[model samples]
Target: MDINRMQDKIIAEFENLATAVNKFSYFRHLKKISNGSQPMDPEDKNDRNLVTGCSRKVWVTAYKEDGRIFFKADSEHSITRGLVNLLLKVYSGHTVSTITNTDLYFLHEIKLFNYLSASWMRDFLSVIQRIKSLAIVQHLDAAPRS
Candidate 1:
């Protein structure tokens, strides 16, 4: 599915949870599922992939295959990991241009900022910046040398 549709589906899922606590619980559940299935490789935890702004240790790595970008991420904190997983669900398996250009309306649609601490939000934005930076690098690398 496209990014917007994926984001809308997530918003609908979150909307089904009536309370903030329920939404938070859903994130924890997502974290558990994400960790079980896609544990980050030890090599990917290096400084090169580590996202620096987060108080919790977070690592994000990106690769391009068949002209689509894919992201894999892990975090020391459960909520952070879940949040990253949420972003990965929306942004992964897309072209570099698509990833970079898309406006992340889901963040607002789900009212995520209201639940998270300022520092956590900053960290989350850093994760996004890292993803976009990786996408930009991939675009540049793929460009024909003038």
Candidate 2:
């Protein structure tokens, strides 16, 4: 699925929930699901994969398969994990160009900024930067050595 469609699906899911508390519950639910389905390897939780500038410890790892970038991330904080999972849902399995070019408008559409504290929002932005940087590294590594 494309990024916009995935984002729209998330927005729709949020639209069903009537309250801020329910929205937070939804994030926890996403975190639980991500924990079960995408456990980060212990080796991958090292310094190289660790995302800096975040209040929490978040690790993001990326690799390319069949010319598409895939990411696996884990965070010490549940809400942070859920937020990153949301990003992964949209960005993973996309080409480097697609991932780099796409703008994540879902954050505003879902009104996520209202729920986040300044530190958490900063952490979220850091996670996004980490994902993009990893995608760029994958792209450079895949380039032909002319």
My TM-score estimates for the predictions, one after another, are 0.88, 0.90
lDDT of 2 at 104: 86
Candidate that scores best on TM-score: 2
Candidate 2 — which pairs collide? none
lDDT of 2: 0.85
- Scored against the true structure, residue 39 in model 2 reaches a CA lDDT of 84
Q: Residue by residue across 1-146, what tens digits does model 1's lDDT show?
A: 89999999989877776565565576666566467437789888998899878888999988888889888899878778888888988889999889989999998988888778789889999999999998888778877898
